[model samples]
Target chain A: MTDADLSRFSINQETVKQWSLPELVEGCGKAGVARVGLWRAPVQEYGVERAARLVREAGLTVTSLCRGGFLTASEPGARAAALDDNRAAIDEAAALATPTLVLVSGGLPAGDRDLRGARERVADALAELAPYARERGVRLAIEPLHPMFASDRCVVSTLGQALDLAERFPVEEVGVVVDTYHVWWDDTAAARIARAGAAGPGGGRIAAFQLADWVTPLPAGVLLGRGQLGDGSVDLRRFRELVDAAGYDGPVEVEIFNEGLWARDGAEVLAEVVERYAAHAL
Target chain B: MTDADLSRFSINQETVKQWSLPELVEGCGKAGVARVGLWRAPVQEYGVERAARLVREAGLTVTSLCRGGFLTASEPGARAAALDDNRAAIDEAAALATPTLVLVSGGLPAGDRDLRGARERVADALAELAPYARERGVRLAIEPLHPMFASDRCVVSTLGQALDLAERFPVEEVGVVVDTYHVWWDDTAAARIARAGAAGPGGGRIAAFQLADWVTPLPAGVLLGRGQLGDGSVDLRRFRELVDAAGYDGPVEVEIFNEGLWARDGAEVLAEVVERYAAHAL
Candidate 1:
């Protein structure tokens, strides 16, 4: 890795899902970002093999896959299918040469009042996939979403919660994706980051660092409107400093999902993301 | 307290601010609610003495005063005014015989980056007001708003955070107000409630237990839109059970601030609140 590699950043494709894979690659290349994180739906839409080749051919690194872990369903058969899908996602991440596969722990099983039990199912699902991912040289990055999404999205809602789950597997095979949008509001964010950096109860692992700004008065269905870097209240420089302090020198990927950004030209969005990463992040 | 007391829930005035004080009182009385939480602005607007008399004449308990604490400003003049206003609010709470004066710890001071500094300022401000409140026989309940409001509204964002602040003052003078809307998503909510109940850290010191539903797709300016019980995702019964387990047998106040509820007749809103509290919150 060169000096360029040290400052490497990626534009998560969700930031411009409206664009095609080739267009995203061209835009990221023009923006001087050496990497990009892709979502599975778009990969499937473009054909996984072709998508992987396009990323490689564009001379861009596929930093990580956007997701793969909704393994908490009411039926065992559905859960099994999700695991199978995740196994396939892991293979895709490996083929794309990305080192980590982001895992979004799914929500409550129907008719189940036990949130903790649902969380346990996520762990069981991860454990089943850990060996296969490790064999393929891909790490699982459990991304704990905002607590607001605890019901219908992710039961794991804190970095500490994700770290606790990650403790069940080997550090190299299982770590966490620290997304600022989801965890910035947490009182124990710094402590949890430090813990994730340390030799975990599971293993010393800090696999990925994802970034997005925190905006106030979060609009409903908050899965969208992720503010562009430096556009919202979160202090990205401080976040970068915290991540550096945590002893993790991983890629700082910009993973925003804003309607405003999406509506713009993909190249323009990528260019703005790169400039913000340079100006606002260390 | 009669078995009737068990059915007596309070509607925070903000829940039906569109209603006049006398109208709210009449509505609460009609709904069989034992109490109502009043705000300083509304009390002042309605005439404090007249509001108190109306509440009394209507046979309603002033469960608490809605607020009095933005003591984390950078200017001494503003801080002094906050203190003076809090003192006046205490007098009003005393006039209504309301037991608790709710305190919302203000956000970071202008030009100040230290969250800990702002928190300390809140503690100092509380210390200054504790004696006056004790003399008035009014308890100050520090209400920790959710962390999304940490920068602009309140720095105190967790029950544990509020409890830590409460420990700085005497148990009789200062305590925490646990609102389900603010703390329902906390990972350690049950443990924190149990800890608050353990009295002085080890056992029962929760000063107030307030109820509201946690609705999803939270709208902008999230200070509003608190769901009525059972209308949203929160498990009010679990909360009640936790508080009961923590040894708090206080009145379970029903506080909803939904636009839908607000547009309805105050009496109908109050009636629905009581019905929901009984059916869903126990």
Candidate 2:
């Protein structure tokens, strides 16, 4: 495939979760994929500086970081630890030279029936972290997971809500991740995307645009059931066009979490993703 | 439980799906539960007229009918048949003396990415059915399934979206169902609940109030994973309070769909549900 074909395509680390950091860098280099989204655990495992050097030497840009937010913990000790870890994550993103650190705001605390209160805590946590992230040249991207994850994974469940939270800070410090699997069901998402992209001090909150299809019969726990690009009901092309119209000329990172895909060969999955991006996303 | 304690309680049929119509009637009678929500399939299996007579003789009021929607079909023939089926469902609700006929609007037609078109088709189907339903003294209740079911089961995924659709028709003709399981995750649900219960022609669209809990490690398919009241993270009492504050004093129906609950003896399950309702939802 031509480099131009994959100019905007980025393989999120979780999408090819079987690959080691070295293997990921080597594979992307060989496959002519110039961009990747890395996760914190593996980066830390391989030593963040070394891993960052490996990607740089391989001529692959770190498009974004997998995550840095579980900011819904209510306990003082746990909350403090969470913020410290997030600060570390922000540092890791800067070290990796990625512009964005995606955040999946944690869901309700155990026995906590106050969803509003949990969400408010997320806002409070962001208020603390945004300035820290900005100082390190990393944008904190608030991702609104599907509502099914609202109780256990992330309380932020819509683009509008993400923007509402992100708009509380400067666009440079905070932003939103528009993942098709998470926000595709909202009829108002297109309008919200336009709002996020509108020009102003508060606009351009589209920090990272990620792609994953919403397939059903979501596996038990519903965590790793994201479908491959063309295998599910999401209109990937429409989302791409929407982001394009909204002036987000950024990497379209593929971030499926399917066990089936993970079981396949990493290079094979990467190649298939490139082909899928061309056929479905463009 | 005393008569006053169980005053607003309604046992939805699916919660004790293993029970026969006769068993349900006898069981509710023995438990002093005055209200029951009926499902079309079981009512039809027992003969609609006979089931209606049985519940009536048992001194039970039918709070609402289980469902009467799949109204997003695109094929002309399928669309006509779906409308016909919904009409029969409305007639059955009327026969059973239930004012509300729940409509789970169908998702996109196969391989169709147009969610807006599919939802528009639901509005079209409702336009045709609302008058027929009003003539029979039935309010067509648009029930928004959680977004996880947006691809295959229902496109209506929020109270706001349901209200948007329901507002097009007269309040007596169209309304929305407030089920805690489906809507507990939405940050805007409480505000929308207040809107649904406001006074006037545009308001008071809450035709049904159902309760179920949100549990984690959702089972495959995610359909039968609804938790028993007090068994999961939902703020059942708060939802009840919200509805109460919004001027809705309707039947509080318990509608769980867990495999474990279904495996138990129907009477035992009903008694447990009653106990949990008292503890969690009152």
**Alpha carbon lDDT of each predicted model:** 0.81, 0.91
Per model, the share of native interface contacts recovered reads 0.27, 0.89
For residue A4, give model 2's deviation from the true position in Å.
5.7
In model 1, the runs with Cα more than 4 Å from the true position are A1-6, A109-113, A200-203, B1-8, B109-114, B200-204
Per-residue lDDT tens digits of candidate 2, residues B9-126? 9999999999999999999988889899989999999999999999998889999998999999999999999999999999999999999999999988888888988989999999
| Winner by DockQ | 2
Clash pairs for candidate 1: B197-B203, B197-B204, B198-B203, B198-B204, B199-B203, B199-B204
Query: Per-residue lDDT of A76-163 in model 2, one digit per residue for the tens?
Result: 9999999999999999999999999999999888988887888899999999999999999999999999999998989999998999
Q: How many Å off is the CA of B226 in candidate 1?
A: 2.1
Docking class of 2: high
